[model samples]
Target: MKICCILCDRYFTPDKMQIKKLRKHPHRIILCPECHERIAERVRKRKKLQSLKRHPEG
Candidate 1:
């Protein structure tokens, strides 16, 4: 199925599993692979920063 990424607004074809999930939950937001990876990397960096702030190692 053709889906548009909410962030990038680019059209992409989702795989079978993604299609099934979207069908099951229409309210869910879809992101293209690139956008998804970008967001994931940002989250990982944020989490690492938070951990470092909580526990400092010298």
Candidate 2:
């Protein structure tokens, strides 16, 4: 079976991954943990940039 990447919306075979569930809806979907971590890291980075923009000294 191929697992879907929630971030890129691509399908990769199970043989090529470390699968994980989408935190918001864990039961209905699956993704490779690396992809999930990348997505989360991107979000975190974006949020940090936004916060920095809001508070220039911080």
Candidate 3:
């Protein structure tokens, strides 16, 4: 089925994916690979920075 990426507003087919939860969501919105990767990378960097702020790694 075709779903729109909530973040990038691009349409993509769910054939390339298999996330049942997202598929069943009310908006039926999904993230394209490129947008998902970019968001995940940002979140990873933010989490790493938060950890360093708390631990102060040398």
Tell me the alpha-carbon RMSD of every candidate: 0.8, 5.3, 2.5
Q: List the residue pairs that clash in candidate 3.
A: none
Mark the regions of model 1 whose C-alpha exceeds 4 Å error after superposition. none
Candidate 2: stretches off by over 4 Å? 1-27
1-58 per-residue lDDT for model 1 (tens digits): 6999999899999988899999999999989999999999999999999999999999
lDDT of 2 by residue, 1-58 (tens): 5667776788876542233333345576566667877889999999999999999992
| Best-fitting candidate, scored by TM-score | 1
Clashing pairs in 2: none
As a TM-score, model 1 comes out at 0.92
What is the C-alpha local distance difference test score of each model?
0.95, 0.69, 0.77
The TM-scores of all predictions, comma-separated, are 0.92, 0.52, 0.69
Q: Write the per-residue lDDT of candidate 3 for residues 1-58, one digit (tens) a residue.
A: 6677888888877653446766566555568888988999999999999999999967
Comparing 1 with 2 on TM-score, the higher-scoring candidate is 1
In candidate 1, what residue range of length 10 has the lowest lDDT sum? 1-10
Best by lDDT: 1
Cα lDDT over the full model 3: 0.77
Clash count, one per candidate: 0, 0, 0
